[model samples]
Target chain A: MTLTPILAMRWWLPQDAALHGAALDREMYLALWIMTGLLATAHLVMLVGLCIGRREAKRSIWRLEVAPLLLLTILFGWMTIRAERLWAATRYAGADPAVMQVEVVGAQFVWYFRYPGADARFGKTKPELVQPGEGNPLGIDPGDEDGRDDRVSSELVLPIGREVDLRIRSLDVIHGFSVPEMRVKQNAIPGQVFHIHFTPVHEGRYAVLCTQVCGLGHYRMQAAVRVVSIAEFARWSER
Target chain B: MKIFSTHHRTIGIGYLLLAGTSVAIGTLLSLLMRVHRVWPDLNWPLWGVIKPEDYLAAVTMHGTLMVFFVLTTAPQSGFSNLVLPEQIGSRTMALPWLNAAGLWTTVASLLVLLSAFFVRGGGPISGWTSYPPLSALAEAGPGQATGMDLWLVSIGLFCIASTMNGANTLVTVIRCRCKGMTWGRMPLTVWAWLTAALLTVIVFSVLFAAALMLLCDWHAGTSFFVPAGGVINGVVDTQHGDGSPLLWLHLFWFFGHPEVYIAILPGMGMTSMLLANFCRRGIPAYRWMITTTLLIGLLGLSVWGHHMFVAGLNPWAGTVFQLTTIAIAIPSTAKVLNWLMTLWGSRPTYSTPMLWSLGFVSLFIAGGVTGPVLAQPALDAYLHNTFFVVAHFHLVMAMAGVFSIFAGLTYWFPLIAGRRLD
Candidate 1:
């Protein structure tokens, strides 16, 4: 079966609103690329050093050994300090005070998403009430008043240019929640609620695949993500 | 003690040879998976390419062998089995028979591990954690039947070997210091090994306990990790509802986290000593370096919660575990700086061993930088399971740890075999 395309046409690789977040990804990638280049360069220098500095009858292998060591230390220290700054900016940027909070529950194979109702509150849905096949025991709980206006869907949707807060959890086993375009991923563990904040700058669709092997259906545990224009999202939600 | 005894040197050489073999095998397995990802159309007559069942088995073998066979044993047991006693000036390893037992048992474990391939079902797919329900039942994956049973047994045997080797190291270090080598004068490598062995005492005991419990669930009928009402594959799991699966997690990580250090702390100590010696200067902050080594070991225990932060653990638990995990960086960073400073303003020796040591520091810094980031309760909520995690772990767990072990082997080849190996 031919699946839909994943890489969408874009002016930039990571088209996201959080400017710091976008920059962090590019910087880190470039830093690693440079590191790799420098490493190969050093290896070449070592080869030359071996030829010149070896205990050969014609050569001394010991010229300037200390200098290279110092250079390596400099490279290492610079990378560490640079990495520290990026790590802080990419992962810990403040979350917007106003954003949609969605609770995502992943069990054995499928993912369930619950939207806070008009009350902006998630009603209780007991694990026992969950049953497979017959509307899913993990389905929405209509008993609670707040469950009435809340929307439930297997697909995840976020408004472009708006921050979205994901409260991720797994009802059974471990499942990884990942958005390739966003470069965001976190493990959904039982009894754990992981949170992530990201603002989509491009209006496009992406796939969320489970990176962790939770079970047999793990390979097929795929979710479609729709990053819609703000008006389009509002129109869809209003429906 | 004897200016590099022939026997000690030979033992060191043996470690290099064995570790090399495991690395070769494990690396091949990894490449198989990577290539398979690129070429799913693989077909090898009798051995079909990349079946779902095969992926699980390979994953199981990859993790099992790498973690126990290569990563755990190579550095701590294989190296310490040969080096620590010598480094401490002991004439022979403590309980020499037990020492041999460690090797044989490890061999036996590898045999049993590899034997899973020929078994009816293949190997268990339930990640290395092998949580119950999936791990407790014999029908979870292709090899869930007899193969999983052997997997448990192999691991059990491996744990026994580790305990023996750990005991030997602890005893030799305590009882056999060479003349004038006080605890103060002991090489940092010796300190790291002793500290790692002490940590292993807890690590092996818990894994052994968990293994025995798993055996009981798989064979004799117990529900250590399964839920009673849960039916796996249409058949109700035997005696399920009564077991507390999380107990295994608690016990496993208790040893698992320290086991992480058991893999790295030695490299840290080795790096420290090598840099100091190669630089032809005394290691600055000798007291602080030793203190930090000990602290890295002690603080490692408190950070297990970092693994469970998102497991619906108390939010407050997140704060505590994060603090404990991040606290480790203070001393760890100190060690990194110490290495950099040791080489400052001095002529240094450049050899294959030195190359590996420098690489270790680089990778350690690269990976260790992210440890604190992932430790943040809030931040880990995002970066915990991505390729980012994969990168960090690969850097430290295999790259730094395995590379340093490689360095040790190359550096000490003359001592072991009397001929330098490039």
Candidate 2:
């Protein structure tokens, strides 16, 4: 069990593409190290006990046993406190108003993304008006004034170095919207909207996948997430 | 009275055999899933290429059979029926007829669940959790028709049977102990079984209610779990409206999380019992071990929301669930520390049971350490519904529970069979 080869298995995690990826990877590495140390120490103690201890019945005392457990509790408490802070910061912290906003609606076998146009507001959508492939995949109300300039696309194109807040929903069944590289995942539940925010620090095309078992075409339910430069995003959104 | 002549032991043995068969079949299904993962295009005899529907069916059957039939049946019902009374110096369970009825009912449920594979359109594709409206609408997928209905009925039957066994075990433990067998004098195995039975009764009732509600949504046209204005398979679901899908997730995981403990607590107790026996010493912190078990049981109920963190739960609720879920690690860690300390100053005899016990501890620790990572809603958002969560649970719950079952069977083989396994 050499350390080099195991740590070298970097393919286990997708490449870091989001601003928070480095922080998450660092925490993951730290947790793994702590777990490995604890595992090794426990096994080592067991080995020594087997090799050197007597078979005679010794009255077990609480004082000696409780010491290690108390230490473990302290360590666990410290880790939990640290991890909780990180979680609260990521999950509960309010999103930046300057960040880009995208609405993602997932159906049985496809992902549909909507971007607010120059008005910076999205038009209302009615479930009754939802008719897929009839020029209204997301059921954007035709009569709504703000919806005329709303750009609906199948691909999610984000501007790099800027935070993006995704409001996720499902038109039908439950689906999971996941981008492995960005370390972002949130369920697209029907009748409810889930908010997930991440900033792509790198410019790359990543595969956006549905992690949930949606249906028979679950394996093929995917979309492309292209993080482009600001200029390129401006040009693309204009088109 | 002849022990084997009584219906208690016979029913116990029957449950064990059925559980064994279920495990065997479940393992094969899991193997199919593994094979399909690596070689997606591979075709097999009779089944041909493993289509997505087939894969979903295998996944569904594998989880249902292993969780309900094998894990729940073998450790709690099977072993407790045979050994709990004997450990308490009693001849048989308090209600032998009820025990027999429970066993037979479980067998019937297993049959009904397996029958879905042969039905038209094959077995249910909704996975074991059976989240709706995929599970609610027959037109949602291929197997959502007859197979989903049978799946619900089977689960309902299992819940009833498990509740009966839980009641019987609780009654027998309370009343059938020998005159001198005080609570303190009882073995750890008995304590584990008692706690597990308590959980089974409480949790399975909720599960049964959920199953019934789901059945109503399926057949009786009730809108309990199915939301209105939803479309499945390109058709609008007109029968149901204004229902909440999240309602089902809340109810299901409420029972589901405790069900994890029900599957593992007995194994924990059995491991404690074996550690003491093999090391030729009592657990170092015996009172703490019992206290930890109780704490784990109580804390287990509060942590069910962890499963819903990524399922669109409120962020504040997710934080609360995360805290409770992390609290479980405290008691769980105490149990592990106590086990290690029990073996600290004594030589451990490496019998088959002892080996299994050691393996259980090692595997459990590996599994337990991963809990805190997943307990974080921030982290679970990344890991949920991935193979990472799957591996985490398989290591902690399934593998750990199975190891304890193996340990118990090997330890009690001589007493049960009147001859040593070797």
All DockQ scores: 0.11, 0.57
Give the per-residue lDDT of model 2 (tens digit) for B1-422. Answer: 34334467667777788899999999999998989998999979888998888899899999999999999999899889878888999988998878877888898899999999999989999899998887888777889889998999999999999999999999999999999999888888888889989999999999999999989988887988777767655666688867788999999998999999999999999999999899877666677788888888899889998998778777888878988988898889888887877777677788999999999998999888888888877777777888779988999878888999899889988756879998
lDDT computed for candidate 2: 0.86
lDDT tens readout by residue for model 1, A209-230: 7877765566788888888888
lDDT of 1 at B329: 69
Docking class of 1: incorrect
Interface RMSD of candidate 1? 7.2
DockQ of 2: 0.57
lDDT of 1 at A104: 79
> Interface RMSD in Å per candidate, to 1 decimal?
7.2, 1.7
Local distance difference test, each candidate: 0.70, 0.86
TM-score of every candidate relative to the true structure:
0.77, 0.96
User: Number of the top candidate by lDDT?
Assistant: 2
